[model samples]
Target: MEDWKKLYENPPETGVLFYNETVMDHFRRPRNVGEIPDADGVALVGDPRCGDHIKLYIKVKDDRITELRYKVFGCAAAIATTSILSELAIGRRIEEALEITDDEVIKAAGGIPSGKAHCSLLGVVGLHYAISDYLRKKGEATSGDKR
Candidate 1:
């Protein structure tokens, strides 16, 4: 296992493992960290297993996401992941945005800790939910929706 993982598994009683500079940058100055009042679609997703939740909002124009925003209530990883998701989704076509994966988000964020990888998955899931909501509102087929 990685040293960070070992440290996390057997944490010292008096210290905390700080997130890397990239993660800290995102967490401290998260982009698109709000709601879009005139959003074309909005989705709220939660990980019952981890008790983390995210609300994603999107504005679509000509089948492209013109704007993206998110509100996250979770750990630094969750917040950073969602922030990165918004950056990745904005200006992309709905299908293209849907193609975004957890791995991409993790890579864009300079890699999240293995134990917190689920947070990146949640970010992608949140974006998918938002796109699904947009399709549903437009009366389009949502058969491609993956959860």
Candidate 2:
């Protein structure tokens, strides 16, 4: 009990944020950071608390996402998460791509600090919105729209 208390009181040396090598690599040179002209679906989403915005573009071919790209204005966490999300989503089927989540993005980015968890949300939200747009344009029902 005393040891636990002491450990809790005198925690490890940590700063405000923690960014591992993978996170820094993605942040410094993010992947698929651009717009796809004539994109099949496009979506823009933002986080009010962080003032982070992302515009995701997708090109679908034969029910699969042939390409994925995005433009993000945010901190290092947001950028890194989004970059990883794009890489995971591209070349995936619509259903599989739609399943992409913030957790996966964070894991791929080497796990961001809990304080910056919302940064991962920005990317997954953007991807979902774009997929919704694509489904709507195809006259298919989205998970929410299938009422």
Candidate with maximal lDDT: 2
lDDT of 2 by residue, 1-147 (tens): 998888667755663246889999999999999999999899999988879999999999999999998999989998999999989998999999888889888878877878999999988988999999998877854444555
lDDT at 46 for candidate 1? 92
The clash count of every prediction, one per candidate, is 0, 0
- Judged by TM-score, which candidate is best? 2
| Predictions in order: lDDT | 0.87, 0.88
Q: What tens digits encode model 1's per-residue C-alpha lDDT throughout 80-105?
A: 98888888899999999999999999
What's the CA RMSD of model 2 in angstroms?
A: 6.7
- Give the backbone clash total of model 2: 0
Q: Which ten residues in a row have the lowest lDDT in candidate 2?
A: 138-147
RMSD (CA, Å), each prediction? 6.7, 6.7
